[model samples]
Target: MIKTIAAWIGSYADHPDPRSALAGKIALVVASNQPFYPLYLHWIVGTAAWPAWLSLLSTPFFLAVPALARRHSFAGRALLPLAGVGNTVFCVKLFGAASGVELFLLPCALLGTVLFRPDERLKSAIVAALPFIAYLFVDAHLGEPVMMTSDYARLVALNGMSVAALIALIGLLCSTQLATREVEIVTTEIPGARQHVDISD
Candidate 1:
């Protein structure tokens, strides 16, 4: 099942540049995993409400990421972080400041850093900046939560765990991509260098 999902993500990562292709794959992975969040919140955590159900409305936008990547890698990369910002903001509004959903902005910012090519510094900066802007906006404007919870600590704890899990997942994927690129670079620059790589570690 994991191999199947990885292959599906790879199909959309056909950009000419390795970095861009990896960016698209990262977007695709995030897109594919999004639909499960509401489920986890509603069923597993039991902290979701009707407003939380509305969060699913954003799933289609995320699902469109691969198609966008197919047409324009940069657009797809841009969309993922932008959409994540919107989604996180909306969720924070739904659950309020105490729910800790706003913590997701960290990963959204991290995505923007790796999704764009090094030469596209301006675009990456703009994308990355949106989260901070949204964070401030959310902090200042959040008046009342759409869904109120009796146990603020539980919601905060749950969201903290969720955010931590997401960060770890994204970090692992980004690190794996970096490792693969290093190997590719070494082999390409020096023929037969691939044989020196140890696989039994």
Candidate 2:
């Protein structure tokens, strides 16, 4: 069932018609234009919360994963600084504060790299899950009695939707890469009759 779902998603991504792209673009625009844009408006605009800062810091890394996978090395490199700034801001926000929240970007960044690199199936699976792990941690922190509220619920929903979109995008990219690799493999194979030098001896 999982395989079927993955294949169906891959098919949609691999052969995305104009309509699909348009719909995707439209959705993104709407999501971005909402009264509380998930990343910036809700998390950064009015909040002095440390967790919000941490969330902002992590955003660039998540955003850049797709471009990195597509071999956009320069852009990927550029995102590192933004990610760093986010980390710094988070650190400042959390200074002299309780350390109950497990915070580490290294594993996540490594997983992202592994996922983006070609021919690393196990690593890709691990990397694909990194975001969810981070999400769980964030959810735990945000769902604490002190942090939970009706407004926070909306923020959680927005964050969840953003994460879902990121995951879908990554899956689409990996599928496209796999399809391209398969096409190349098939194209390069020589038929029995087309072999120029056949040595059975």
Candidate 3:
């Protein structure tokens, strides 16, 4: 069943790197969106504590993941910072402190390197990390609980989403850096010079 499912999904996941990246994006989107379903169920049943808009507004950030996987420069460049800031703020607001949900900021920050080309990585990385960096500078010390309504169940759900998102991004990072060049090695006339190895698609 596993192999069969892999084969089936392999059609959409064309290349190895993209396959991994796509998996990560899908996992992020699913994880971010997952709570909405349950929350909506409770909302319908009139038992939800959290407002629906809190999660609803975050949809665009996750939705950008697919475009990033497609190598859309705008999406890759814009999304990391957006998600990082939005999620980090939400974490502090919802839990009234530095909750573990803020952990996803690291992976989102690293996406600057993983998702973009060399030319864009630095700028992307700076943007991705700036929000968290600014937060550290402004609110260096913890304040009194702001939204003290967070419960154990909510914490578990938020942490679980962060873990799942991190695992997916890690998988993307590890999926056999498809050699951008051939396997053969050659000598160069210049001392300490590296030979350029040609790669095929």
Give residue 46's lDDT in candidate 1 (0 to 100): 66
Q: What is the C-alpha lDDT of each candidate?
A: 0.75, 0.39, 0.52
TM-scores for every predicted model: 0.82, 0.38, 0.55
| Cα lDDT, model 1, residue 177 | 77
Alpha carbon lDDT at 33, candidate 2? 36
Candidate 2 residue lDDT tens string, 75-139: 34324333433442343234211322222333334324533335544534544454455545543
lDDT of 2: 0.39
Return the number of clashes found in candidate 3: 0
What lDDT tens digits, residue by residue, belong to model 3 across residues 1-201?
Answer: 989976654443333344335434443544456566436334332443354346456666665554564575446446645665566566555445434555555665555455555676566666756666746763344455343443545554655675676657565444544432222223244443343332222
CA deviation > 4 Å runs, candidate 3: 1-48, 65-74, 138-146, 150-161, 172-201
State the TM-score for model 1. Answer: 0.82
* Better lDDT candidate (2, 3): 3
lDDT of 1 by residue, 1-25 (tens): 9999777667756576555565566
| TM-score-superior candidate, 1 or 3 | 1
Whichever of 1 and 2 has more lDDT, that candidate is: 1
